[model samples]
Target: MPSDVRRTTLLTVAVLVWTLAGCRTVNRGLTEAVLDGEHARQWHIRYGSQSFYSLGDEGLAKIEFEGLIDRERVRVRYQRGMQGQAECVADVTTRLIEQVELRVGMTITTSTTIDLLRFDEPPQNFDIQLTVEPNEFPLPLFVRAGDESCTSILAQNRSYPYVLMHELVETSLAARAGGRVLPDVGYGWFGLGGSVNNYTRWFRDGLANYAGYLACEILSDEMDCPECPTRVAPLLHTSPLSRLATVRTRLFSWSQSSPSEHEREHYNAALGLFLLIEDRFGQQTIRDILADVATRETVDGRDLRAIASQVIGTDVKQFVADFEFPMIGGVLTPVTRALAANKGLNVAEGLLLEFVEPDGPADRAGLRPDDVIVAAASAPVADTIDFELALLRAGRPASIPLAIWRKDAGTIDVEFPLLYPGKD
Candidate 1:
């Protein structure tokens, strides 16, 4: 199969496992394991295995600036202690206001605040936090301090500007959605009554991610360079639709909740859902969905479904059901046969790989799709969680032995070099 289709298939099977597993804890761990593996592989490919460098006390000093957008004052701050980096951030923030204004079709009369900080370690990515007051017109957004300036992509670090644009887009959406005072129906897991809260949160989060995607796309286009080091490339490469498939399938069951760990899945799923809406119903449908969100005092699944159905002129539940479980005719399917077959394996058992990234560490080490990874680094890999723990225990720069099984080949072992030279 083509790489993209194979990736979709692997993601589908992983999500099905999460939805069908009887035990929530086990399922959560396995899902996390699968995701973490993918993240580590992606990070390694993008940034390589280079260690982080501290900017010292000088780099941690804060730089602050002010601007006016739509006649509303905006405050921007960062800790890079560099004139160019600060200027880049300020410029992006200004452009973001214009992009958001055009997309939301509003004047954005509210004042905004933005902060950018640096971290001392790795897991080098960016995230946003929005604080809103009841009945507030403008919202306060914090881009939680990260070592963004210290991280490099494609041999140079231009993440600060791109990340700033993303956070601003999210903040703009939140401001339009009634700021911080919007009612929270305890979305996610078994909160309040029924599944509406969970789906509502999903819709809200998905919209924000899509907004970020839109902002990034604008920036990417203006650059007019395919390798311009814009944030959109990585976001596109991360395969949000595949990740959303996992979130949609395991919504009520999966329990892992660290924002740093799970935000990508949430954002990716949200963007995917939004993109699907645009693809099927048109951009106007997306605007209508947001408009519905802005006018509602309380958001519930029924209300959301009604708004969506009204916009599409069809049963929204069926639409959602189709999106959530796209593989088996809008129904949850089990992988009991695969799980049952692993029972006889003497080594640890886990999800079998359907496709490994070409030239990846596993591929280079002779690991192939359909190989049941029973153990990692001599540790029992009964599931994804165990597999992740084993990988962690093995650490970087280690030759980890993977115990595998194939129908014709029987029990065999392959050694994967963690943090391989060039790949890292």
Candidate 2:
């Protein structure tokens, strides 16, 4: 639903705005006074869109930033209205310097709280005032909670053992960064413009991160966030990892969706690996390692087997051989074994098997037992766990495409009209 909002491309108007803004040197100087080094080098930059919502209300989307940050308490205020406009305000505290560069802009340091608002509002209503300097703009600075710089550190209070802020910050960052679809092997860097978009995969990764955060909280006593899935699952009372595996398998077996068991398994396996690395190294190591692997090939760039050998300094074949993926039906299958025998799969574990309902569309299309469905349409269906889940999540009947490995015919593509199971 969020993705459905069409982005308008007003080429002529945008071009005219840019051209007109560039033509007036005096206006440019005045505008630069705000964005340049004046006013303690603070700015309130905003971008957003206006759209009609289903309720006939104007929906507004926006983001805003302002001020130099000197303290840790970064306060941002956001208000949404039924009309096609929103307001955002921020209070930031930062050290002042004569000159500083943040990304593409040159800025000055001034300790201050900048109050800024954006809409189709008049400038006089929101114009901020400050003491003028003889040669340059003097920056206004404010400090909250007793600190003069308008960015004072909160007094330490150890009354409670729970550090919710820390957890929230960590999880928020993790979720923001997690939504990446990863390559099973080869160089780790996400490739762009090769008929595949890395950001799209990253979006999926964000979901996985959310799952991980929930898993961590629910299974904290037995297994922490950084523990390997192998080690963590064994520790949990309900075995969170096991449950995830089960859910993934079941989702795969469902009637609709994308992402095969192989793909899901690969994702879970990477998660498991991250936990393992965290357990062996440290909790912080997971992100660092992932970032490294994501930007470049592993040191060896061979395969997981090779990398595992280097990291654990042991023969990984036995461990790989022993690996099994769990199914919601309480079955365990040796994914690694199937993979080792060249099953033409991506992930070795966490596959699902979904049988078409009797007399249903898949059945009418000739799908049979042991069909080894790989994916539906464009969705990846590596195994039964995630497949089943995907199917149940599909809200309507849709055409399904599958990659099946028949014992007699090998791998082949099949299309079937898939209706909602209950409805069919």
Candidate 3:
């Protein structure tokens, strides 16, 4: 009887250990599948800001647009009879790049090759997959494949043109800002000094979406090209700034837990900042910001902010603050450093009203154009950013008291009502 009991106990213990191990194995597989696959590659392209200049090794060129462009120009070689649906979007991408070339101040002036290709008959009951023919010659573009046209696959995926937009913009801007072919200067210590180029990821990804939307809107109205496909159109509406505000988490710093988490922070925050730049300055200013960013490989987060501040003529943090809280229903421009010195404000921290919408919350609350915001909620506002932070600290109240400085009337206290609900 004692021997029987011991055998039973051993069996039970063995079963429990095996069950636990099985659970762990399943979980480990799931984690690897999710993190180490296509999702992982997406992070690499955007956050890693993959360099097209150096593709000496096959490892780096295994990406979506890998080896798509040869050393020289925008040339895509497809199989014969490949002109069906694939060439449509390919044409659109080419024309869009041409327009971007004009906008970013590069004329291209080189011949572009777009060949539509389709392979011969495959085995019966077999589907022929389209792929890119590798460029051994000086051809401009090559798509990877095994007896298939990759462009056809892209057109069917519905993310074809919009995804192509950003890549083209990035490539075009980099080519023009630096040169058609940029040389690789390795970063010191595991490429650490330059790999975490927060600015590159921020600008590359944000401007991609920012400019992509505008480009799509234009093409929709004018060219009837496939800009945003039906399925993916909704994804483009995500406002980077408002999303973070809703979550109540400010941008993540470099010391955060995971690289992916930090990368997510960079994407939304950068887009928010770019939207504000477009609002305060203009579209031209955003282009100019990109022009500066494309040339520098090591411009980190702070460097980007400073460069944007110089171009937009305001402290970049103000933009950060602008999206950090609810909308104040008016556009605010930072008081220039010289003007702030004349006004005795710290770092020239003050906001000048650029435009107040008629009958909007600002207009209704007696905020006028050219009126400077000196303080909010009885707290001194060092700048537009400070004003937003003050609003956030006060819980984004419906109505907050503000001290306004008008040129002729001097300082006046007013209850500024924030009626505009933040981005949806």
Choose the strongest candidate by lDDT: 3
Give the TM-score ranking, best first.
Answer: 1, 3, 2
- State the local distance difference test value for candidate 3: 0.52
Worst 10 residues of 3 by lDDT: 134-143
- Model 1: CA > 4 A from native: 1-74, 77-88, 104-177, 180-199, 229-237, 244-264, 297-301, 324-424
lDDT of 3 by residue, 223-308 (tens): 54332242222344333545445432244232222356456546555555555566656668877865676566645556666777
Q: Estimate each model's TM-score.
A: 0.45, 0.25, 0.44
For residues 333-366, what per-residue lDDT tens digits would candidate 2 score against the true structure?
A: 3344455366554443433234545665556667
List the candidate numbers ranked by lDDT, top first.
3, 1, 2
Per-residue alpha-carbon lDDT of candidate 1 for residues 1-424, written as tens digits (9 for 90 to 100) = 9999999998788677766775586577877987888743333456554453333223323233342223234554544343344445455556665875567433444444444443344334333233444222222222324323312221133443344444444444445354431223334555544322224445545555566556656655654534344444344323454455566644322222334677666655656666667666777787776676667565554566677788888875466445531111011111124454554433333446666777666676787766677767877654443454365445354577877776678878887666522234
All predictions: root-mean-square deviation over Cα?
A: 23.1, 24.4, 18.2
- What local lDDT does model 1 show for residue 126? 30
lDDT of 2 at 41: 52
Clashing residue pairs in candidate 1 (N, C-alpha, C atoms within 3 angstroms): 48-424, 49-424, 117-146, 118-146, 119-146, 119-147, 206-270, 349-382
What Cα-based lDDT does every candidate model obtain? 0.50, 0.33, 0.52
Cα lDDT of model 2 overall? 0.33
